[model samples]
Target: MLIFLSLYFLNDIFAFSGSQDLCGYCFDTLVNSFDKRNSILSPSFKNEQHPIFVTWKKKGQLRGCIGTFSPLPLHSGLQEYALISAKRDDRFRPISVSEVPDLDVTVSIMHSFEQASRWDDWKVGVHGIRVSLNDGTSIYSATYLPEVMSELGWNQEQAIESCLQKGGYRGKLNDRIKAQVQVTRYQTSISKMDYQEYIQWRKAKLTSIRGDL
Candidate 1:
């Protein structure tokens, strides 16, 4: 019975929709994003837009992270963000196809972006913060995803300061600095998979198909 339950859970991992696991679209994008290809595996996602961030990590360090606040169709958004995050993130060098085998992909589907009453209004682990401030000349903004604070063991002030620094602010962080900022708190539903997991799922799927023949 234990073996059967374990297999049952493994079967669920390979199943795509509503499972919070990487879907076929993610694997397809991982391949096509570097090839400059434009084909999509399934167009079943809604035509409406959903704000998304694609993150790539190699050996548990950040390789790339880029996305948009503007909502776009999930099909195109996933593909576009995947490539952009992998290759175009200005903070790091481009990811090569050779790095694919060691990579982990995380898709963050963002929602409920609400203007926070203050910088400290949101909870650390629950909210992803997007902060913008005009320091006399131009507006600067940066965002950190929900898991960032919890993962880094950052308090609310530390998280906000880090985000401010990310936005290109080199000025002193103080109550005055905090007062001018417009903070929007959001949430994300994330799905992730590593390359080895993807390969395993592919093998399992193929084996299942062959067994049925």
Candidate 2:
């Protein structure tokens, strides 16, 4: 039977939400260098859509952190950002496959985004902040995830200033600049994966495949 169906309908049939074990998918992505857009992921990992940040670290030092504010299917979002953070983050050189053995990947699922009533309206350790400023000619914007402030031991003011600097602002960051910026705060749910975790996940997958065969 031939029937016409809307993309939205297909999306509704596919999209899902809630707790997920994402380590396996990420491990497969790295091992096979697979594109998530074309890869098969567990339905549990693709049920809901959200804005996501993919962070990579080695020895507790930041290797890369990149994400989108725009919501996307969780599977595609994680896969796209995983590769992007590992290879395309301008602040650091691309992470090689050799480095993958020691890399730790953290996936932050963003939600509850709301505009701040004031620059300091959000909590320092509980909310991620995104700030934008216009100097009448150009607009500059940047974001710091919630963990950034607590990890760096920064107060709200310091975090805001650092975000401004990240936005490529060269001028002094004062109350005036802070006043002119629009601030948005958000919260996230985080999942982390280490090399050992990836290995265990891979072994399980291989076992499953062998049993199926």
lDDT of each: 0.75, 0.73
- Write down the RMSD of candidate 1 (Cα, Å): 9.0
TM-score of each: 0.81, 0.83
lDDT of 1 by residue, 63-139 (tens): 99898877667777777888889889998999988998888888777775677888898998999999898999988
- Candidate 2 residue runs with Cα over 4 Å from true position: 1-20, 34-43, 208-213
Model 1: which ten-residue window has the lowest total lDDT? 1-10
Q: On a 0 to 100 scale, what is the lDDT of residue 171 in model 2?
A: 79
lDDT of 2 by residue, 1-213 (tens): 001222222334223222225645655566557344434434345445567788889889999999987767767777788778888999999887788778888777766667888899999889999888898888889999998889999999888888988998777878788789888887667777788887776666667768987
Q: Roughly what TM-score does model 2 have, to 2 decimal places?
A: 0.83
